[model samples]
Target: MAETATHSGTAVRVYDLHKSYREGAHALEVLHGVNLDIARGDLTLLMGPSGSGKTTLLTIMGLLMKPTSGRVELLGRDVTSLDESALPALRRRHVGFIFQNFNLLGALNAAENVEVVLGLQGVRGRAARKQAMALLDQVGLADRWSHLPDEMSGGEKQRVGVARALASQAELILADEPTGNLDSRTAAQVVDILRHLAHTENRAVLVVTHDLGLQEHADCVVRMRDGTIVEPHDGVAA
Candidate 1:
């Protein structure tokens, strides 16, 4: 029930978004009426400085956080007023998140890590394990399916994290600094996989990164500084 933004073929649409954090007596405003549209088959990268609010916007789009005002539409549904209790289920059903640190469980093997996510989505037992292995294979990690986090290279662990993110077959994927910890070569490979999820699988992919290396892979690039989109961009050369 806020002001709207124009868009098409968008899996996620953000309109007039604003966010604030309470700091004692004052509310520190972060996002300043940002608007964006993420297409189902495109990889959108949001780049900005440390306090530019790009990550805040990404979290809001992923349903991991809510804004102070404005609207967020995911797959065409306005989720601005969803109850806190309902968020987990909604996120489980529609969203997948990839983090910079490759947050796999050190104690759990790669397949087991993915299985845990499937279990959250009501997939369990042998079925969950089978699906997890298949996803790992898709990420080209079939050989490392049973490796623990400590046993695998940084790239392999991230690939497992990617498999886990895809475990629930989510429609929207939000990655925060996903390549920050990897070397240049490995980072490109990971970006390629993210693009595959968007282009090949037709999922909506939004990545929040400061790395300019990602510019070439993005279908659209939204640059932010001081909490607003400040530049023009195009997607897919069309």
Candidate 2:
């Protein structure tokens, strides 16, 4: 596979993906020849019970883990065979991650937290601050920019996480149970922001969760079971 970026608008494509781990003398398979596409401008939900390999698939798609055997294309470039050193830069350039714990710096305020990500993208000093403020405003957290993580509510902190993710201008956003720490109402609000980012900003957002309330907001809901996709959603290849 070539590493050329084609104009396909696809954020990620995995073909015949598989993952396995050696436990004692037995090789335990965690993924079973999975095939999927997470397209740009879509909110895709990966849902299933515990130990279903959802996180395994997500880690591979996010370029955080290598599959046992598969082809992974990100932004139309074949990344499965890239060197480990090369993947960090590529993943940093294209992928933004949202964690369930909100992963904010306890010492930094909202704007500073977001600016930290901009710094990783080589935007620093005044420019990073300005961009961070703009992103906080976009996420409806402009007023909370000066508040520390402990001072903010769970929902507010998650919104800041979203802003930080956007600071990198990432084409693909991988969210792992983004709303797990919030109340129902707050969870819905966060999901709304994710969906809006996908539809309006044309970012491909893939969320791994068992939250049934999020189903209605997703463009496609993919269900996995025992390391394999059991039901593929309509309008999306899985």
Candidate 3:
């Protein structure tokens, strides 16, 4: 697949990113000078083992977490230096995230869950409800809008999460282990939907997962070992 950037040629760009956490008096570095570029109209898989910093990279690109040092550009906008107050609006308009646990509210039905996202984008009332149902339909959850999270299967809930994330029509999608809780068949279906979003909708999709089965469907594959990118066969040295 060509590295097409539907939004001026690049969807999300990260430069020399570093992240650290304090465990007692010791500083544990999670990401070390990680650099990456996600292009529109392609499904990019960020694959690695546990504690490989793939999720850390996803959170940073999704603007949910700040990096210790480095720059992040989304749709050519410099988001690293922006204040916390500015990020919410940016994320609302530009980014959508799909989480491993689905993250759907237990109290809210599928439609309501999706509607909440639309409300943040200034769409509300009957209009938001209608749009949410429509998005749910697109995610293959039609006629199930009134179903609560506990009532649905794991795949169904994740589909609802996908619908919720795309309710605002955000161009950049960051999915972290979206299929982790799903069975193999269900996981493949979810991956198909994500690929459709990237290929047909011209959206940029970054999926952080350890599911090697997904490699066959990726347009571009990025492998991370420890805190950095590496070849698929490269082993981390102690």
Q: Which candidate has the top score in TM-score?
A: 2
C-alpha TM-score for every candidate: 0.92, 0.94, 0.90
| Alpha-carbon runs more than 4 Å astray in model 3 | 1-8, 231-238
Whole-model alpha-carbon lDDT for candidate 1: 0.83
Give me the runs in candidate 2 sitting further than 4 Å from their true place.
1-8, 233-238
For all candidates, what are the clash counts? 0, 0, 0
Q: Write the per-residue lDDT of candidate 3 for residues 1-238, one digit (tens) a residue.
A: 3333343367888888999988999989999888787888878888888999988888898898999999999998899999999998898889999999999999999999998888887999999988997898888999789999999999999999899878877889999889999998898798888877787788888888778888777777888988987843322110
lDDT of each: 0.83, 0.87, 0.85
Ten-residue region with minimum lDDT total, candidate 2: 1-10
lDDT of 2 by residue, 1-238 (tens): 1111122378898988999989999999999899888888777888999999989998999999999998999988999999999999898999999999999999999999999999997999999889999999989998999999999999999999999888887899999899999987898788888878777788888998777887877777889989888878332442
RMSD of each: 5.1, 5.0, 4.1
The residue-level lDDT of candidate 2 at 193 comes to: 86
- Tens digits of per-residue lDDT, candidate 1, 1-238, equal 1111222367788889999989999999999888887878777787888999978888898888999999998888999998988888888888999989998999999999999999887889999989998999989998888889999988888899889889877888889988888897888788878877777777877888877887887777778889988764422211
Error of 1 at 51 (Å): 0.7
Deviation from native of the Cα of residue 224 in model 3, angstroms: 0.2
Clashing pairs in 2: none
Candidate 2 vs candidate 3: which has greater lDDT? 2
lDDT over C-alpha atoms for residue 8 of model 1:
38
